[model samples]
Target chain A: MNIRELILNPDNFFKDLSSKESSLTTPFLIVLALSVLNSIYTYYETSIIFNLFPPDMQSKMSIIMIFSIVSSFIGGFISWLLIAGVMHLISMAFKGEGPFKRTLGFIGYGFLPNLIGSLITILVGYYFLSNAQVPTLTMEQLQNPTVAEEVISSIIPKTMVYTNLLINIAVILWNLGLWTYGIKYARDLELKKAFIVALIPVVLFLIYQIYGVIKML
Target chain B: MKKLLIFILFLFFLLLINPINAVEFTGIDYKNEYLEPGKTYDLWVIITPEKEINNTVIGVSPYGVGSEYIQIIKGRDYEGNLLQSEKGVGHFIIHIKEDAPSKDYNILAYCNYTKDGKKYSDNRIFEIPIRGKPTLTVENPSVINEGINRIYIKIKNKGTGIAQNIKIKFEEGNNIYALSEGYIKYLKPGKTGTVEIKVYGENSGIAKLPYTLTYSNPYNDLQLVDKRETESRKSKTITYNYKNQKTVEESGNLIFKIIPNDAIDLNVKDCSFPVGKVNNFTLSIKNNYKDSKFTVIIGKYYIGNNQKTLSINYGEIKNITFNIKVEEMGVKEIPVRIIFGGNEIERNISVNIIGKVDLVLTGVNVEGITEKTITGDLSNIGTDKAKSVLISVKKTERVIPLRPYENYFIGTLNPDDYGSFELHAKVINETDSIPIVIQYRDENNNLIKIEKNISIKNLINPNQSQENNDYIPLIIGILFIVGVLFLLYWNFFKKNKKIIIKNNKNNREV
Candidate 1:
């Protein structure tokens, strides 16, 4: 459910794609739908960002929540289609027994994993949000000099930040795996050549994520 | 649903890249919601039970304050009507105007929460105190003349909050060796309380003497504490040299002739007063020469709006009086004093000059029917006490007549319990008298007479005729007639009426 692992394993992403047949659209649509639902629930939890600027700048996480859920949902779908379809197209243009049927089957069944992911995320986040108590920040507590830092450092662990960093790296390696697999499943490339190509997407995404976490830090 | 999805998608994109906002609470605290005179505190709203609770749900939480001074600075239900704003991390900055009444306030947050799409907005209570400048009063602290003993200290809270962990000591004269030992507890707003310190020797003789006191309220949760000091205390001492025959322990007691003797402590040393134009006059003495050697300096003083003081030679004899001249009009209060080492003795004596006064002793002669003439003579003093005058005369047995220096002429007299004759003129403006100036012409060609003034009790008009001789007979005749009428009615008329009534009643019954 944490999408973090999914982003990190390029070989598994394609291996997932290989076992089932799915169009770029179905799993993307499911992810988008789940994301929308998540956003509505987030808004319910955080209300809206009302006082953004000017005199009072009190914004609810609801605004950010809605935006993140929606944009990420759409972007995920788009990215899924562009990468999968282009690789499929590249495979079709090349030689021998381009088994579109089996490939589509592999992709289609692979959608199940993300659907489970979305469902899990939605359920966990929703249940938590619904039952969550809005913690009151005592004016004194807020003004206490060390409480904020103590709370932040204590809650968000270094592993999470580092893992997120790794996820970006994994994004590139996964693309490389898929692209190399295009040659293997559709063009029937030799195992050695396909294995060499599988590592590219994870590397690029890794570089990008390095920039990301640095900026974040 | 599609639009909602798009909105969600858009949000997801932004979150994937956007930075979290910082929550700045610009002094809207009642006390900062801390209840300041002009500033306000924000009511931070956030997701409940969120590990990082920096989010506030709009239109949900109910905020209320217990104080009348709580006003929403901006961005609340209305622009300026009790405004509460979204400060990131669940804090809102509210603005309150100056001149609001200080009080305890409440902000209740109310909102509906939906887990699995179920919604409810419940209320929670938050307390804020809006306080004015805390009233400061320095109370007389309980002092053990021991370590850090405070002769005077204050309990002070300059703000509305309870001042906690207040520690203070007499900054200059604290007997305590270290400050950590001097700890005074909390104080409330505008409240007064005492702090006892035994930082000094509680059993020492110095404990009885007033000392400089100072203190501070470190925590604003209590009342303001003021410092105490002996320097501002009022005192006087009366010291004197007894006949030198009295014991040191029995150095005669003193009485403030005008004021109560026990009203305050007095130190007596060598002091003096000025009489007439002469400069030196004895006022007090200092004779404390038993256990320790001490010196006394006599001084002259002038009292009024502008008081003046001058001291005599140190270690001088106890009975020495100093000389000093002053130029002033009307009533003058001159405080004569003696300062021995640190001991002081002072007394205020008053004198007046340059005013108008007159006096008379009156009696009348009956033969002439004229108002009486005053035959007594009186001298001239200042006008101040002259009007409240008294005069006395005694009949002489040998008639050793008047002389200029007989020392008996009348004059204004200062109150004297030990000196001379008595007569009081307290009630009225004037008293009338008749004096029989008795004269006797003996067989020889000589005249003997004595004059004595007798008071006239009545001032009513005197009638020409004496009517008692004429009215007595008339009154006697009227009395005789009334008696005869009473005798006739009782003996004849009453008896006749009784018999007639009896006869008539007997006939009617038959």
Candidate 2:
């Protein structure tokens, strides 16, 4: 039930969850608290991103960023429910045994390592934010593809972006590893079947993220 | 069969009744087949007798309608006799009315002659095609370059027929003179023939050269006969302005005024010199034309030679170097005159002469030793003024330059003006000469510096005085170092002892 046990001892942490009955509301609140912290970091980073725009556009982007933050918060809770429900259903198909509520609670606890990673990312992002030279970007420059490339290249250092990407990948990999054990303990399935069930949600989430990135480009 | 025999008997009776004539008109020849309206033309008709018949007369009628579009001019020889030759030919001058229609007309040629005591008259009629007139246009007016002009004339036959034998005669005027005539042989319908005429303009103004263009369309295609009509147009006016025309064409007989490649070249061998110094400049005058004499007059100035006039021959170059004295500083331009043949060009020679500055150090007074203040008077002994004068003693290997003895600032000093300065230096070895540097500006406001060495006149042993003054800052610096170390110990170590004692009390209470 404790967040410290979930982080330091994740294997025994999931084993304990398999033996006892837990309430989904408490685990859901814990995940929500971590999501709020991540959203606050997102707000600050988005504000720093808006600073690169011209004065006229920065005012307009402030309104858009507020809308985006509200949508992301709602979207995050829906995604957690969706992934938990999907994992419960997959476990049932594999002839495993577990309550739906327990699977959902274990899925929430599985997000602990990812929350720690998000906290570290916010700290590292602050270091980059202080050293970054905000480019003078205008609405006209953003509309032009060539000028947008120049503005982005000037503001974001390539090495820092690639390093941040690698860190995020490592953090996701760590979260996926924890979720595999969480699924195995909750579903009472083989390790291989638990990994396949865990991998399905993460891979689908990665595909959705890649699709969003391609749409932006 | 009986009807066929009757038809043959009738053809035989008609052939038997037909009589053979002694004289016959075999061929008919006309001067021109195509005629133009409103013009006179000549038509020669050839008449042939059976055996050299006498008293032969030839007549020609070129008309189809009731209108008189054609008329005969001459049908007899110079002796007032009919045309009597092997093939008796008649020369007739025909004129087409101005309002004649453009269509085909019939030309009737009749010949009456006496051949071997029998009179015979023969007549022949042929179709003569009447066409519209030829149009003459001046393609390009006379373009005068240098002194020659080329006039272009074009003739186009806009009529239904062709135009033959085009002759153009260009008339000359006051400013224009014709060099050659323009002529074109033939120009078909919707076709043009271009010709160029060479003309000469004697003066620089508008030249009006009237030209007469004469071309005749053939009334008859065969034979050498033509309409021989003359059509004259108005004169073409061409302006010959030399100032506006700077580009000279390469082709044609162009007479251009020859000058130097560089009109008036003024070269200063040495452009930089001292003020009030005499400098020499090379003035080169070249005449590119032959049989021309040049007279050049120079302006008044301070020169080595009083002769201001110089004469140069044609195609010859004259380089004159005159020494001139510039009285003031800064950049200056000298006026020069270049007159060659009938052409004159005014030019200027630029020179930069700088002013010279001289600073003299006099009346050195040395008062003290160890902390020595050397005083002297600096006077502007040159011909120019000095500004922002400052004096300082440079540091050397043995002697050290000291502070609290600042550089003296003397503002602007005119010619023969003087300013005094006081300097301080610590002399480790009295044998060394103190370098006194004085920085100032010349008449041109340029920053310059002058250095002078003044020998130490009065020397004294001050080793004990330097040793006594050195202990003051050394003792103060050591006392300041001891106070900073005590503050660091009280801030860090004293605060740590209080925290350790508080933690021990808390552990005992637990």
Candidate 3:
């Protein structure tokens, strides 16, 4: 199925895909593309935050950028595997049957929305960081957790944080929708069971995002 | 018989001599009994005969002690005949020389007459006294037209005798009045004696003083003379010049000029000034003279020109201003001396200096709890101006000064003027008050400091209470999160339930 059909008629597309041979190649390419977008967004966001470090630590920003990009690239695939594993295990409770490879492939496709969200967040963050006045801190000040938290929070604009939170919530809901149909079709589970399986992680992730927005306020 | 014949012959001889002596001097009449030197007098001699006589001639001539100084005129001797029981008159014109001494002199009167065909001659001597006359004059008569003026009138004796018991009586005039009379007991010839006459004049002008002088005449006191002329008393009217009437009446003295009561009126117009500031002091002066110059001095300050001269026109009122900075508080009297026409009038002007500067804080507002910043108004309530005003947070046990606004500087504050000041401090412990210090300089450059405590009991700390209790944004955030979640459920699960149920029914029917 094309990207338009997968996004518009995800239930029918995933059900038709589940009936065919489940190949990991397209799913792997999708996950790799999402990971590459996540890494680019993380690298940009981390580079802006690195300005809060002292001059000596800021000189090592290249190393910090590489590490953060590699971790976010790897973390994107791990998050896909974790979501598929969690959904498959929860589907088993309802006596749902699904191959682990098919569940993982469906979960990798769920991250396509995250790639768009990351691109939008990176654009918004660039605008925010361009205008933000970040206060430089000493090593001793950075050691203090409270001082570090205050400095970080002050540098991050509240509007950017709220906007990113709303974008993330929308993206998470879209992924949940795709994952609901993907799990229902690939695991051969009831629609209610798949929705229940999707709602848990989405609700928890939304709670976390709302708590950060409230804390920022 | 021989004794009777001799007695008859003696009696007959005595009787014949008696007829010859019958034409003796009965009395001498002269114009003056006392003859003064360089003067002429007429003397009349009367002679009587016992029987009728014809061709009687009588002549009088000076013959005694001072007769050398007396001369009888040749053509003025009387020559006439005498009758029985009638008197013959002899008139002589005598002149005393300029070098005559003052003494008594005798004049002889001789008469030749024929009685019963026989020529009889008789001579008699009359005494003439010479004495001096006293002439009095006044010298330098002048007076001041003020209260009681003591005028010294020099009484000069311009005669050849001693004048004694001289009494002078002053007559009142139109402008000048006599307060008392004058007396000089004795005055020698060509000598001058001063008599003090007390007088007062109501105005300034020439005053005519008519006076009568009475002195004892030594020549009249020594002998009785025929009353011809009296030279013992003199009457004269003297003119005395009066000046400075207004000056004398106003100041009661003559050492100063005539300054009218309204000539220069001085008044302290404004004295409400501060202690240390250079302020303008106004003095109102009204001039009543015809464009006169005056020097005004207040305390140690001189107004106007280099010599402190101020020229003002007639009936002109001017306000004189000078700078004054008083150091003390209270009502002070500043000595003022106004000098005009070489005279000085001293006066005292009271200046109420009021009080000094006092600063108080109002509308004090404190912000943070740990780091507090106080802002309020500082005012000067006194009459003085305060300069270089500074307000700072005082360091205490529980309060410490902070940065940015530890001390606020306010340049100046006048009387009843106020300025805003802000101070920042760090509060260590919970306290109800924050200490602050205010410093300023007075007009005299005296530094003054005041300490006060600002209450912070009613102030709310935004960092603590405001941040914690502000839940409106948090509630909105929660509501937004719940709405997003409901939308997600309805759009992904609730709305797709019909499609899912239809798919399920198609699968079951197949």
Candidate 4:
């Protein structure tokens, strides 16, 4: 709050952030590769596989499902680039040479957030496509074959509500872990140091997400 | 160099890759111009595939657009198995119900080509519209009888295709004739031809005119119909007949001319050319046939002096001049007579002949034997000379000599200009050769003027035969011209419109 309190605090915060950056580097890369591959596969499935059911079947879904898929891709790609830029700034603060190459390795591990986010989103995209109802009465699939109620229920159910809630809540947790790992990974910070800085967005996002859930409810 | 080569390779690859999905096949297009319901229409199917292929198959299911609900009963593929699963690539035909709904339908082309006796499905969608069949058109028609009723029944095809087995029948009230009896014909699109039907009075109760057309369009599998009726009121014929009447002639060659006053109607056959009030009538023959009957309206003219009955001839000459002589010394105006049958016209002329006298006075006035007197006369001797007729005044020296022919009284003295005058003269009795002339003198005979030279036929013993005479007609004629000018001024001012002087009315000039 005072000049010394504001200035001395961020220096201590960055010193603690650098100590944990060294510890999350190896584990962050492992998880990032996993999440990336997960997002790539689901991206193909939602773009190609979901649209394959014919336009009449696909047309009736709400834009929330459309936005989530699009934003998931956009947020995934943008998050990778933004996290890398932030890591390069951290490397410049450290006076490290080879900024571009080192910055690549530094926050390339930031894909972990989107990867973890997709693992959760895929479960929801799967549920929505399979359970969404057809808009019109299907004659061939009905009376002659006598399509069962269970079949209709299984084909198109309202899964977007529950899936959206679960994924959004998981995203806040995933993003906090990613930013914390990113700050420390560039500066080579310890778990105890990085964990201290991780509380900032953890508190902010929790407040934001709670407000969103309340409005929707 | 290697990097540039790699960049060029990448650019070429991008161009080739775009060919597979080049055009965006937005949707299928169909119009009623070709296929509308039971009517025919053309459907255009364009597909923008996911990727390019050598050839793409298109299928049209004409119910509406969507997952086509056409029944695919279990059938054998080229491999001859139960064809539930789709083959590699092939085509199919589906029959639409006659009562199919008219709307948009989706066509799915399931290409069936066997790969290891299995079927795969690759489909594209196009919309086909189902509409009603074409409707028939029957036009209101007309029949015209120009040079005998030429009944033109034209069944022109206005539809897209040829109307098959075309037929037209005409029904006039209770009577009807199939077009096959030479009363009907067909016309191709945009052309017209005639059909002639010669008809006689059939039963007298029906109208003699044929008018109507029933057109039919037998399209695809549907039968749609419409009707038209011709309007009424026929045109009738009008005939004309004429009659000729008698013509009355207007007299005189020039319209405003002096015709003989006693002319009457010269009738030839039955008509008369009215030569109104004329003695010399020129008869013109005209043949007028009214109701095909000819007649000479007026016969040729007749002259009493020429011929009694001259036949009617337009260019015939009959010179008819007449003269009748009488013995008289007095001034007599004699007339020549012309008669057309009972019609008589008398033309007058003066035939003055003296029988027992040498002279006669027309204007002579003398009370006693005086010198200043003269007389006018018209004479005829036939053989002998006239007497020395003179006025020997017993107290004066005046002598007036007379000529032996008709003479009007000139002034006793001669004038330089010729005009009417009046004066007095005396006759001189002379037995020998003597100058006998009537002279007018202003007292002393200084300017003596002779009125006439007289020849002495006999030396007379008469003491005096003189008279003072004057021609009073010359004074009366001068007064008549002045009277006419005064009457002209009176008539002009009396009949003319009067003008009021608006300005300076107080100043009047008398």
List per-prediction Cα lDDT, in the order shown.
Answer: 0.38, 0.62, 0.71, 0.36
Better of 2 and 4 by DockQ: 2
Give a tens-digit lDDT track for model 4, residues A109-196. Answer: 4344445445545554553443333322233333422222323333323233334444554554444444444455454555345434
Per residue, candidate 1 scores C-alpha lDDT tens digits across B1-510 of: 999999999999999895433222222222121345555455555433321222234321225433344555433331111113433223456655455556655665443333223343334455566555433344432223223333333455544434444544333232222232234465666565555443343232232222332333232333213333344347544332223211111111111112112222223342222233434433343343222233333233322222223333333333433454444334555554433334333545554422322222332212111221223333323232242233333323321122331223233333221123222111122334432233323223244334555453222111102222323333333443344344334333564577689999999999
Q: How far off is residue B21 in model 3, in Å?
A: 99
lDDT by residue (A44-117, candidate 3, tens digit) is: 77876786677888768789789889998999888888888888898898888878999988877777778767
Tens digits of lDDT, candidate 2, B331-367? 8887665555565544566777676667888898653
Chain B TM-score of predicted candidate 3 relative to the true chain B: 0.37
DockQ of 4: 0.00
Best by DockQ: 3
Question: What shift in Å separates residue B59 of candidate 2 from its native position after superposition?
Answer: 99
> How well does candidate 1 score on lDDT at residue B170?
38
- Top of the candidates by lDDT: 3
Q: How many backbone clashes does candidate 1 have?
A: 138
lDDT of 3 by residue, B1-510 (tens): 999999999999998876337565688876444667777777778777776777788787778555678877751344556567787777777788866767777777788777667777788777877776667777643324334566677888886667888877766665567788778888988899998877775554445656667776654532332233334458344332323211100001112122344557787788676565666777888986467787877774333332356787888988877777777777878777777655466677888775677787878766544567677898888777899999999988999999889899998999899999888898788788898888898887989898998886534221232234334433443454465466556656665897789999999999
DockQ of each: 0.00, 0.01, 0.03, 0.00
